[model samples]
Structures are given as structure tokens and as C-alpha cells.
Target chain A: MVNILANPARFLRLAGAVLPWCWAAAAVTGGVGLWLAVFVSPADYQQGDSVRIMYIHVPAAWMALAAYTLVAVFSAVALVWKHPLAHIVAGAAVPLGAGFTAICLVTGMLWGKTSWGTWWVWDARLTSVLVLFFLYLGLIALRGAFDDAERGNRAAALLALVGFVNIPIIKFSVDWWATLHQPASVLRIGGPAIHPSMLWPLLTMAVAFMAYFAALLILSVRAEIAGRKLQALLVAAGRNEPAADGLQGEAR
Target chain B: MTAAVTEFFRMGGYGAYVWPAFAFAALVLGGMAWRVLARLRASEGALDRMRDRAEGGRP
Candidate 1:
């Protein structure tokens, strides 16, 4: 299945067909999620209305981890299978993951300021997540450092694999340490610690954010493929080669 | 609705921190999306220029 989908044209066609549905789902689900999060869920008794930040912060944190995991998985596939599209997918995921991670950090700080009486802390959870953010930046920078695209891809893939160790550390940091950040509430082994009303909206928002990431990732990958094709065409034109031949060579 | 709006704006006394955080998130998300679309458009334009040159100078 991976080899079959390795063809760029086939991937492009499939991505194009699915892209609209992904965007539509993101828009609809995000709308509903926001409605539920903002209006329906009751404010926390102690934290009051400031508790609303959980809706956005939790989802962003989840996506940050989820997106990095995706990049690492795809990077491994790209390295092992030598799939060209896998590198592009991994490249596209980095910025989005970084953005989500940034959001998580910022919102967490804000929540902390109000609830924990500090803007920041050097707790295990916060520190590990900061490392995760740096790992993302490192991958993005490494991708652009090498002139040879294949070498850059491989190096970045290796970095991603090495960074995979941090994801678990970030997840378990709250559990493993006396931290300001709360431990897993919704993802507990037995059942969620949250109320049904609050839990539903949080889950909805999480799904919506995941869909949003999917839509944005597809867009970024399509743009990357188009940019690669354009670069090849320009190179072919500069060499006085036929554009038709250039495109045909690519399609193969 | 009015009471909810007032409470949200006031953010239950943590308005300063809460509102700015939300605004910052919006800005970051919006800025990233804008940058992606802008880059895509620029690449498309470059492709069009390349295509035109290839076609026009075809012998």
C-alpha cells in the first residue's frame, strides 16, 4: 500500500479528492467545538471562566505531540522505504506541529499565571515540552541547511527518530514528577475524571483540531509538490530541455 | 447572553491574562495560514512564468 501510493501523481489525485472533505469537516467540527466549549460547558467552580482555556490549550498540546509523532513515523518510512512523498509529508508537518506546540506553551503559561500564580515554571512537564518545541525547530532548520535535498531529508529523518524519545517523556512528565501541570484527566486507564458535559466538548474540540491539522497538512504537501515540479521545470528550461520531457520524467 | 459576555470579557478577574492568550493564539494561527497561502501563490506565479517562457520560446 505504501509503495503503491508512492507515485506522486496518484498521491496528488487522492489528496486533491480528499482535501475538500477534510477542510469541510474541519470547518464544521471546529464551529461546533467552539460553540460547545464556549457556551455549553459550565465554568469551573474554583477557576471560574478562566477554565475555558483548557479547551484550546489541551487540544493544542495533544496536536503538538500527535503531529510530531506523525513526522517521526513518516520520517522513518521515508528513510527505510526511500519514499519521496514521505519526506515532503514530514517536512510539512514540522511547522504545524511547532505552531501547535507554541500555542500549548503560551496558553499553559497563561493558565498558570492565573491559577498557579506564575507566568512560567521549570517543572518537568513544561521543560520537556519546551524540549519538544526545540526539537521541531531543529528539524525545520536542518531541512534547509543542506543543499542536497536527499541528504537533508535523511538527516532530518534521523533527527526526528532521535526526537521520538521525548514524546513519551513529555506525556509522562506530569505523572513522574511533582509538577504544576495536571496529570492525564481525560485519558486515564479506567475512565475520564471530567464530567460528561465538559468532557464531550473537550473531545469534540480535540477531534476538530486533528481534522484541522489534516486539512492544513494536505495543503502544505500539495504546495510542496507543486513547488518541486516548478523547480524542475525551471531547471529544464534553463538547460534548454523540453518542458514536456521534464514533466514526463517526473510523472514516472 | 449579556451576563456571559460580561463575564467572558472580564474573564472572572483574570481577563488580562486570558484574553491576551486567546488573541495571541488567533494571531499565530492566522499568520501561519496567511504565510502558507502566500507562499503557495508565489510558487504558482513562478510556475506560470516558467510555463510561459517555455511555450513562448519553443522553436
Candidate 2:
């Protein structure tokens, strides 16, 4: 599958084929998740209604980490095998990852204010996630600074790989150090700490967020390809225009 | 029915915090989707114009 999608045409065809289903899944799962989260799920014994924020906050955080993994994996593939589609995907995923990180931070702050009685804290998990957001921004800026697309892609991809060191830090921060953030609940060794009532909604929201990412990522990649085509066309037009404007003879 | 619904929307007095979280997610995701599609449309239009100009100017 990855080998075949190394070809941009094949990738585009697959993306187009899958995009509608992606949208449908995002909508259906998102709807069900929201209903369960807001209406059906019980309020936390301690946090009360504020626990509803967990449905959104946890999924965004998960996606933030997942998106960076997507970037690093795609970047590694791009760097090793010279896959153009992989580069485009990693580049397009940067902004989405950053957006998810932003959601994670904002919702966390809101929840923190109510739960922890502070708006922001330099806890290990929060700080590392902040760094992850910055890495995404750095990749975006580094790519834009280059004049050539290929150079930009490779430079950004390499930076993404280097920035992946932050991922493990973010994942383990709540564990390796004492932090305001709670330890892993759902994916821990002894099984989920959360009750099934909260757990089901959280899992549904996770599925919704993943589907959302798929739909958005495919759309963004399509747009990025179109933007590249436009740039190539404009460059070709500029090169051909002078020759046809009767300046061809003077050059010769 | 209406009172119960309104109470639910109140989010047990945490509406201020709860509503905004979902709102931010919608705003960011919706805004990005809008921008992506708009740019794609504009680029396709520009490419078409360039192609048309090239063909017409050939004669």
C-alpha cells in the first residue's frame, strides 16, 4: 500500500476514493460521541460537569501526539526512499497537528482552572506538549524559508525526525515526573482507570477525531498538490511569456 | 421538556468552560477545512486561466 502510494497519482486516486467515507465516518461518530458525552455520560464524582471537557481534551491530545507520529513516520519514509507524496503529507499534517495541540492546551487550561485552580502550569506533560506545538511551527517556518520545494521538503522532514525526540518526552512526562496532569488512564498496564461510562464516550470521540483527521488530511493534501501545480504553471508561464512577446529575437 | 433541555445546556453550571472547548475545536477545524478548499478552488481557477491564455495566444 505504501509502495503504491509512493506515486502521487495513485495516492491522489486513493485519497479521492476514501475521502467521502472519511467524511461520513467523521460525522456519524462525532454525532454519537457528542450525544454520549453531553447527555448520556455521568458527571465525574469529583469534577462534575467539567469532566465533559475530557471527551474533547483527551481526543485532541491523542490526535496531537498521533499527528506528530504521522509527520515523523512520513518524513522518515520521504527521507529514506525519496517519496514526494510522503513529503507533501508530512507538510500538510503540520498545521493540523498544531491545531490539535492548540485545542489540547486551551481545553486543558480551562479544565485546569476549574480542577487545579490555575490556568496554566509548567508541568511536565503540558510543557512537553507545548514544545511539540513549537516543533510543528518550526517545521512550517523552515519549509517556507527555502526557495526550492525539494530542499524545503527534505529540510523540514529532517527537522521533523529530529523533533520526534520530544514525542517520548511528552508521553512519559506525566509518568516520569510528578505533574498536575493525571497518569494514563485508558491504555495503562492494569487496565483502564476510567469507568466504562466515561470510557465509551472517550473511545467514540477518539474514533471521531481520527476520522476527522483523515478527512482533513486528505483534503489538505489535495489542496497542496493543486497549489504546487499552480506554482509550476505560473513558473512555466513566466518563462514562456517573454519569448512570445517579441523578445525572442533580441535574446538570440 | 424545555427546562430540562436548558438545564442540560447549562452543563451543571460549568457551561462557561465546557461550551468554549467544543467551540474552539469547531472553529479551528472548520476554519482550516474552509481555507483548504478555497485555496484549491483558486488554484484550479488560476491554472485554467493560464492554460487558456497559452492556447489563445498561440495563434
Candidate 1 C-alpha lDDT tens digits along A1-252 = 887448988988888898888878878888898888777898888898788888889999999999999999999999889989999999999999999999999999999988999989899999999999999999999999999988999999999999999999999998888998889988877899888888988988888888878878888887888898888777866887755545544332
Q: How far off is residue A88 in model 1, in Å?
A: 0.5
lDDT of 1 at A237: 62
DockQ (C-alpha based) per candidate is: 0.51, 0.53
User: Which residue runs does candidate 2 get wrong by more than 4 Å?
Assistant: A241-252, B51-59
For B9-46, candidate 2 gives per-residue lDDT tens digits of 89889999999998998898788788777877887777
Which has the greatest DockQ? Answer: 2
Task: List, residue by residue over B1-59, the lDDT tens digit for candidate 1.
Answer: 99988876886687887777778777777776776777788887787776666567657
Per-residue C-alpha lDDT of model 2 across residues A1-252, encoded as one tens digit per residue: 579647777888988999999999999999999999988999999999999999999999999999999999999999988878899899989998999999999999999998899999899998999899899899989999998889999999999999999999998888899998999999888999999999999999999999999988998898887777777655645776433323123332
If you assessed candidate 2 against the hidden native complex, which CAPRI class would it receive? medium
Q: List the residue pairs that clash in candidate 2.
A: none
